[model samples]
Structure formats: C-alpha cells, structure tokens
Target: MIRLRTVEGDPPDVDALVGMYADFEADDRAQGIPPIGTDLIRGWLTGLEGIHVVADHRGEPVGHAVLVPVDGETLELAIFVHPDYQGATIGTRTLGELLDCGAAADATAVELHVERSNDAAIALYRKYGFTAEETRSMELRMRRPLVTPPVA
Candidate 1:
C-alpha cells in the first residue's frame, strides 16, 4: 500500500529520496529535472522551498510532489513518481495532494514547465485544470488557478 503525507517542519529523508531518484529511468526525465547525479539531486532537493509531499510504500519514498513559491500568490509545481510506481495512480494522487497543500497555503496559482514530448504529464496537468500558457522551444508552460478556502 502507498501512503501519502506532507513533509512538515523537519527536513525530509534526503538519502532515501536520492536512492529513489538514482533508480529513476533516464527516459523518464522531462525538462532536465530530477537532475542527473547524486550531488546534483541532493542539491536540488535540499534547495527547494515550500510545501512537499511524499508517497511511501513500506516506509520508503516512491514518489514526491512539491509546490514551490514563485511569488507571494503563485507557486511552481513539480511531481515525480518512481518508474516502478508509475501507471498505478500514484502520480495522480500525489498531484492532488500537492495542489491541496498549495490551496491550503493560500497560493492563488501554480505553474509548471514540461517537455512538449511528455504527453502523459501534460494530459495529467490538463486534467487538473492547467492550461498552456506558452511554448518555448522544447518546453511548454502550463498554469492553473487555485481556489482557496474562505477565511473564517
């Protein structure tokens, strides 16, 4: 079973996540992400700021999603699922949880850049209401508005 949860104040288990990325398939990369080496992956993960969620199976991370602030009211979103865990709805659930976290944090919008060739990811983003904002070379930019809850 896969369990999903937000990463709170404490830092995430970087080594475990690195291990997961290490096993990531090269063909699965999009827009040059999930970096390419141990140090690069660690640097990228540690430098990210904002909400993070992890999908764990048997206490090991198999997927991750994040909503990083682009400004006060907007955020940039990214998600990745280990190849072994793809096509089983983990990406969909992880993305839903990440968006929920973004809405709860009061973000007004979220954006992402994906390779134009990544049809599966683009379809998933569109399913969640993201629309194409621009196309730059091999990448496509997409954005979606988040509806925050009413203030009490």
Candidate 2:
C-alpha cells in the first residue's frame, strides 16, 4: 500500500530527496542545474510548503516526492523512486496526493517544467492528465487543472 503525508519542510527524508535529485541531475547534465549540496536543497525546500511523501515497504523509504509551490496558483513537482522501486506506481500515487492537496488549498492549477529528453517523466505526467502547453529550450511546460470546490 502507498501512504502519503504533507511534509511542511526539512523532513528526515530531505537527505534522500537531495541524493536522488542530485543523481538525476548528474545523469542529465544539461537539464537546468544539479543540486550541489544539502544546503541548496534545504534552501529550496524552505521556500515552499515542501510537500514530501514517502512510500515505505517494511518501514524503509522506497520512494519519495516533493511539490514546491510556485505561487498562489501554481506548483512545481518532482518525484523519485529508488531504482529498486521504479516500475511500481509510487510516482503516480504521489502525484495524485499532491494534486489533492493543491485542490484542497484552492489552487486553480499546477504546473511543472520537465526536460523534453526525460520521456519517462513526460509520459508519466501525461498519464496523470497533465497537458503539454508549451516548450522552451529543452524544457516542456505541463499543466493540470485542480479540482475546484463547488460554488456556495
């Protein structure tokens, strides 16, 4: 089972998050920039609500995700599953939880900038209902409508 929680900032899993992101960035050198250290990752996490969710198996962290709010109405999301857990649906579940939280907070939409070369992520986002609205350089801007509350 996949369990998710809204982590405010700097959870114990921050190290894991940083490691995965840094590794991914290293693997794709031209995709923006790689996180150099914990300090930078912490600084980035500090600016937003830092929604972090972990999927555990037998009390071990196997997958993790983070959603950084871009503004009042937009958010940037990233997820990483340990190579051992890559084929599972942890990423999908994490994305769903983030969207639910954003909708609950009255956000109208969420957006993410993903490198076009990252076909797996692009495909995953599209599977989760995100639409590619534009592209710049090697990055693609994807957007998804947040579920809105009914008019009172």
Candidate 3:
C-alpha cells in the first residue's frame, strides 16, 4: 500500500527522495527538471521552498510533489513519480495531497509548466482543473485557482 505524508519545514529523508529521482527515467523528465546528475538533483531539491509531500511504499519514497511560493497568492507546482511506480495512481494521490497542503497555506492559485509532448501529464493537470494559460515554444503553462471567486 502507498502512504502519503507531508514534509513540513525542513525536508526529511532527502537521500531517499534523491534515490527515487536518480532512478527516474530520463525520457520522463519534463521541462529539464529532476536534473540529470546526483549533485544537480540534490541542489534542486534542497533549494525548493514550500509545501512538500512524499508518496512512500514500505517506507521508501516512490513519488514526490511540491508547491513552491511564486508570490503572496500563487505557488508553482511540480510532481514526480518513480518510473516503477507510474500508472498506479501514485501521482494522483500525491498531487491531491500537495494541493491540500497548498490550500492550508492559503495559496490562491498554482501554476506549472509541462512539456507539450507529455500528453499524460497534460491530461492529469487538466483533470485537476488546470487551464492552459500560455504556450511557450515546446512547453505549455497551466494554472489552476485554488480558491473560489466570490460571486459578484
């Protein structure tokens, strides 16, 4: 069974999370992230600031999601699941939990950039209410409002 947990403040078990990213298939990377080398991945993960969630199976991280503050009311979102754990709803669950964390943080919106060629990721983001805001070269910028606008 997969269990989801929030990593509050300082990230815990970063080595384990790095291991998962290390094993991630290069072909699956989007927007040049989850950087290619161990040192790069470590640097990227450590520099991230905001809400974080980890999907663990038998105490090992198989998926990770984060919402980094972009501004006072918006956050940038990113999610990744290990290749071996893909297609098993790990991404779905991890995303849901991360969004919940975002809501708790009082963030009003979230945005992400995805490779245009990644149909599955685009579909998943759409399913969660992200709408295309712009298309830049080979990437699509998507955004979703976390708070409902008051009827005027």
Candidate 4:
C-alpha cells in the first residue's frame, strides 16, 4: 500500500529524499541534460519554505514532492520518485497533491520548468492539465490554473 504524509517541517527522511533526487539527476544526464548535482538541490532546499510531502511504501520513502513559491501568485513544484517506484502512478498522484498545495498558499496558478526532451514528465504534466505557456530550446514553461478554496 502507498501512503502520503504531509511533512510539517524538514522530513526525517531527508537522506532518502536526496538519494531519489540524485537518481533523477542521473536520469536527466542519460538524456543529454546537464547533471543537477547535490549542490543545486541543497540550495533549492534552503530557499524553499522547508516543506515536503513524502510517499512511503512498507515504511520506506518511495517518492517526494515539494512546493516553492516563485512569485506573488506562482508556486514551483519539484517531484522525485525513486526509480523502482516509477510507472506505478505515483508521479501522477504526487503531482495532483502538489497542485493542492497551491490552494493553501492562496495561489492563483502553479508553474514548473521541465526539460523539453523529457517526454515522460511532459506527458505526466499534461495528464494533470498543465499547459505549456512558453518554451525555449531546452526547457518548457508549463502552468496550471489553481483551484480556489472556499472561505472558512
């Protein structure tokens, strides 16, 4: 069974999260993109609201997703699923939950920068209704309209 936990602060599973991201970077390098090493990931972690949501299976972290505010109305999402857990619909669910995070921030939209050549991720984003708003030779800028929460 898969479980999703909203981490209130730094997750206790930081090591596992970093390992998953490292594997993702290797995947990127395999497809001809620059390797995003631990330094970049570390820098990003520091600037983030230090929030994380972890997906676990049998007491082990299998996926991780984070939301980072980009501007007044935009939040950037980054997700990494352990390679062994790929193709299990985890990415789709993780992304959907990430989108929900925007609502809590009072965001009107969410955006993410993805490699133009990463067809798998592009398809996943499209499945979640994210549309390409702009593109460069190497990257695509995608956005999704946020779901507004009802006033309490």
The Cα local distance difference test for each model comes to 0.87, 0.71, 0.88, 0.73
| Model 2 stretches with alpha carbons more than 4 Å out | 9-12, 15-25, 28-34, 38-48, 148-152
Candidate 3 structure quality by residue, lDDT tens digits, 1-152: 99888886655578997888898777868878899888998888888867888899999998888888998999998988898888989888888888888888899999999999989889999999999999998999999999998999
> What is every candidate's alpha-carbon RMSD to the true fold?
2.7, 3.4, 1.2, 4.0
Runs in model 4 deviating more than 4 A are 8-12, 22-25, 28-47, 147-152
Residue 151 lDDT, candidate 2, scale 0-100: 100
lDDT of 4 by residue, 42-83 (tens): 555544573467889988778877776788888877776777
- Candidate 2's residue-wise lDDT over 1-152, tens digit each? 65565665555565655565455435643344345666776665454356677777665666666667788777777776766677788878888887787777677888888888989889989988899999998899899988655899
Error of model 2, residue 42, in angstroms: 4.5
The residue ranges of model 3 lying beyond 4 angstroms of the native Cα positions read none
**For model 3, what is the alpha-carbon lDDT of residue 98?**
80
Of candidates 4 and 1, the better by lDDT: 1
**Lowest lDDT 10-residue stretch of candidate 4:** 26-35
lDDT of 1 by residue, 1-152 (tens): 99998974433888998889988778867767899999999998888767888899999999988888889999998888999988978889989988888888888999999889989899999999999999998999999999746899
Pairs in clash, predicted candidate 4: none
By TM-score, the better pick of 1 and 2 is 1
Residue 85 local lDDT, model 3? 86
> Per-candidate TM vs. native?
0.91, 0.74, 0.94, 0.78
TM-score of 2: 0.74
Judged by whole-model lDDT over C-alpha atoms, candidate 4 comes out at 0.73
